[model samples]
Target: MTEFADNVRQAAVAMRALFPATPMQRNAHLSAKYDADIWLKREDLSPVRSYKLRGAFNAMSKRIAENPDQQLFVCASAGNHAQGVAFVCNRLDRKGVIFMPVTTPQQKIDKTKVFGGEHIEVRLVGDYFDDCLRAAQEFCAAEGGQFLPPFDDPDVIEGQATVTMEILDQMPRVPDRIILPVGGGGLSAGARAYLNALNADVHLNFVEPKGGASLTAALEAREPVTLNKVDTFVDGAAVARIGANTFSVLSDTAPQDVLLATEDGVCTTILEMLNIEGIVLEPAGALSIKVLDDLRDEIRGQTVVCVSSGGNFDFERLPEVKERAQRYLGLKKYFILRLPQRPGALKDFLGMLGPDDDIARFEYLKKSARNFGSVLIGIETKSASNFERLFGLMEEAGFVFNDITDDETLVNFVI
Candidate 1:
């Protein structure tokens, strides 16, 4: 085994003192749907409801062992990493200072606090991650405390490799393929290294959010590249830049193995998992499963494993997830309609709706015109074809309407 893989095994052994290994269970629902032997490496079942705790524990354990006098640690994160560090700090009884963006969700902040207890103090430093990271780094330097990175260090990578070790132990045999979600690349890099060392005849596939394809960009360029802008819908995996150390390890992977998932597409997977399997997944957590559709033909009748990376979803985001899923599925649409000033016009329009069709929203965009006025409308229906029928009816009735459901600019400003 490579030195990295050996270190990962050691980390796995050490982790047993804290929590049991996450399950690698064959998923009957997914297997049936795709005609494949599908398994889920359930990292979402970890103590912090994510695989992040492994890296945090591994890194901190190594640091503390190296210098027994070291008691203070610091880190900057908006979500999972913060919770991981907090949990580790509380476990080790070490003092920690966690810096998080002010705009981070209250659910995450509360969870981190709960995990860390009195061992960690959270500082809401800035509105953005970069700003908060800077503050954390400066504090660490000034206070002579160890700085725990989210994914850039070798120890963190080794720690994440433990997940792969557990997967091999839990599975009946080597999987034909392993699907991993990439953020800063710690988990992917670590898992790939260990699996390679074990001589597992497995194909590795990496999934990244389309709006934040840092890993894809880096692999294409043969170096890390900073994205111009990132969509934070998959906040846990929405890294703007791939980590340098992680890119070095992942640099040789074939480009075809990397997949990009859209935010709305991920939402559909989340909803499906929740409604069908009772598996609640955060946006980033659904990356691998969401991309299974893209691999349907290739994975059929083959043993495949997808890392369900986290389950720390906030219920407040459920409405947004449902809306995005509906939009992607074509079950919902937004439109601007020119309504005639004549009485009963609204009633006539309502009458054209199918039995399953429902008006979710209606607003007047213009009211000054005497002959006609513009109305902003949102409608939902049981089937996507219902929109076609609705449009046809409006056309036959001489109604002028513009569908803006897919218009990004207008949707952002109006919807």
Candidate 2:
């Protein structure tokens, strides 16, 4: 344990040449809301706007120190990891070949190029990440270049532990609990390793996106397993499988300590942080904060730290984030309505809505019959109970409708 702690401290000190430690900030708004001493490890403020660069830099720096001849680095990533590697490659003066899926957004691609500058090359490969990863591994082997894994490596884990090092140093006293966002588990694993080594009495909470609870799945199975499906909305942490190396460190995590935040729930947190707190957090960055509602009772009066992992949110997705958040809060809904073909029927149905209710979308799916037609409608209201009152009135008036807001399949196709 002492040896591991020493290694982490040494790694953190070595990182000073590249960049200083990220800040740990106490959030007054969250502290007041949760009745706890809420602190945020602002990894979102890092040079790459994420903690990923820590692992990437640690892995690359150590690799070169051990083998000076290793001049070329390779990695496959569509988002933060790619940018991390690019930044590190340029800083370390090493050649980097980054493979990204062809479908990756141009914004991310351009960011990677800007960070790497003349030190790296970008290759757009298959439409999926897995395909790009295979191509990168093959190319690395063929060219005899070292492949830098985003996570799942010893040096990377050591690098990520530096985050915990900074948190402990910045805080006036040891926190009662630390809340971490889990993706492929590198950050959590590293933090867990460091805390366990010191025999800290701190409680740990692991937050995962509900759609990609790979860490929960791994803990249940006692090993890493690939999920059959994953929701990519929280792309930063939407991993299909927990890394095997990381699982070894996190295997003993209690099920209760692993909280799952729904995609809509995360969006709600993102919006709240943006609108109320003036903080822009990416979906994955909001996971730890989103789970605070679940810990409202447990965390009261306790000093807790929530890691805001990244702030690489694209403003173009704001409308979608607002939409999901509205749906989650029950302020918005989509439904299929059976409206009478008669002209007065349309006017009467519109009148049925409460004053607070406003129509956002109205489209005809198809005229099912001469007397009746199916219309897709989206409504935004001030309160959730308004929907219940609105539905009751519709039933009484014989205005048939089906709420498709919660129907995933129907939403994917029609809404």
Candidate 3:
């Protein structure tokens, strides 16, 4: 084996002191649905509920080994990374400083604290991740502490490569293909490096959230380029820019090998996995699985492994996830309708509804109009065709309405 592969194996062995290898379970539902042998590398089942702990532990351990005098470690993260570093610090009894954006959820902050116990200190920094990162770096430099990057460092990449080693060891045979979810590219880069070093012939595919496709952009540009805006719905994988070190390893990747999953579509997969398989997946965790439908033809009858990256989903977001999934499936809609201001108008509108159509929201926006009033209405139904039938009846009855489900600005303000 190549030196890199040997190092990755060593890292994996060292990791046993902290936690056992994460499960590599074959998902029967996915296998039957795709007509292929499908397995999941359940990183979401890790101690911190993410693969992040591997990288953090490896990097910190190597750094301290290189210099035993080093005691202070610093990092900036609003989610998994912070928890990973905290867990490691607590386990090692090392001092750590964690910086998170001021807007981070209380649950995340609490989890980080719980993992670190007395070994780490949590600081609420700026309002944005970039700002928080800057603060962490400045503080680390000032205090002479070791700053742990989320995904860009060589040590961290080496640490994450352990996942690839564990997969090859646990699987009955080498998979025909491996699907990995990309964020800043740590996991993908590490896996790619390990496979290349081992001379493995596994076909690798990458999936990224459509709103924050940094890896796709980097591959296309031949370098890392920051996105102008990123949707935070898939918060775990929504990186504005791919890491520079990671891009070096992933630079030769073909654009065709990278797939994009819509945020709403990921929500659908999240709900499906939760309700059907009793599995909870955060938006980022569901990315690789969400792209399975797109690769059905290529992966049919072949063995495949998908990395479910994290399961730090807050139950508070379940309603929003359900709403987005329903909208993506065309089973829910919001519209503005102009109704005549007369007696029995409400009864007439209710009469136009199909048996499956239920009014989820109804509010008059302009009740003082003399002839007509503008009403904002949300409807839920069993099928998309129900909307068509309901709209047809509304039009025949002389109702004026505009579907606002796809209107981003209006929905943000009113919905």
Candidate 4:
């Protein structure tokens, strides 16, 4: 363990040649709100806009160290990991082949291309990451290329542990707790290794997207297990299966320490940081910060650190983020209304709305019936209870309505 700590520190020193340590900023807003000294480890500000570079760089460097003649590398990633590998490959002047899913955003593909220049070749393979992973592995084996496991390799883990070294060096005192966002678990695993070796009394909590809690599921089962389904909205942190190597280090974690942040709630946190603090956090990056609310009572008067994992968010998804946040906050909703085919019928329904209620969408879905029509309506309100009051008035006025805000099928198809 001591040797591992020493290695992590050495890795931190090596990282300086690439880029300086990412900032650990004390957030005044969060500190005041929680009555805790809150600091954010801004990995989002790294050269690749994520801590992924640390692991990739370390793994590649170690491989080069083992075989000086080795020059080829391969990886599979939809986002940050690809950029990390690309960045390292460019810096090391090595040839790289990155396999990505067909559905990966073009911005990421272009950015990876820009980072790697002529040294990296990107192949768009499957519709999902698993397919890309298989393809990359097959290609790497056939071409005699060293394959980089994003979070599962020991050298990568050692590289990621450098973040902990930087935190201890940057902080005035050891933090009371460290919160990390977990996906395939490399970052959390690496942090755990170095921090545990230091024998600090700090509490460590791992946050996972509620839709894809690979770590929590592993802990609950006492072994790593693949999730049957995963929500990819929090794309960077949504892993269907925790890496076996990472789970080995994290298996002893208490289930209670694995906090889950909802996809919608993550959108809210992203918006909060963006709007209030002007910090544009990717959904995966916001995971650690999003779950801070759950730890407020315990962390009071204590120092806390949240790892902002990445800032590679696409502005094209901004409207979707805003929509999810609004839905989660109960400020927006959609419903189907049965309206009579008569003049002033729409006016009467509009008249029933409270002063704070605003119609965001109103369209007749169908007018096939002779007596009434199906109207798709979207409403925005100042508060959640406004909908309740509006519904009561709607009921009294003999208006038939179906609240389809929470209906997945209807929302996907109509709203």
Q: Which segments of model 2 are wrong by more than 4 Å? A: none
Cα-lDDT of candidate 4? 0.93
Per residue, candidate 2 scores C-alpha lDDT tens digits across 1-415 of: 5988999899889878888888889999999999999999999999898999999998998899899999999999999999999999999999999999999999999999999999999999999999999999999989998998888998899889999988998999999999989999999999999999899888999999999999999989999999999999999999999998999999999999999999998999999999888998999999999999999999999999999999999999999899999999999999999999987998998888999999999999898998999999999999999999999999999999999999989988876
Residue-level lDDT of model 4, residues 1-415, one tens digit each, is: 5999988888888889999999999999999989999999999999999999999999999999999999999999999999999999999999999999999999999999998999999999999888999999999889999999999888999999898888889999999899999999999999888878988787899999999998988888888899999999999999999999999999989888999999999999999999999999999999999888999899999999999999999999999999899999999999999999999999999998999999999999898589999999999999999998999999999999999988878898987
TM-score of each: 0.98, 0.99, 0.99, 0.98
Task: List CA RMSD, all candidates.
Answer: 1.1, 0.9, 1.0, 1.0
Off by over 4 Å in 4: none
lDDT of each: 0.94, 0.94, 0.95, 0.93
TM-score of 2: 0.99
Residue 24, candidate 3: Cα error in Å is 0.6
How big is the RMSD of model 4? 1.0
Residue 312 in model 1: lDDT = 95
Candidate 1 lDDT over 223-251, as tens digits, reads 99999999999998999999999888899
TM-score of 1: 0.98
Q: Which residue pairs overlap in candidate 4's backbone?
A: none
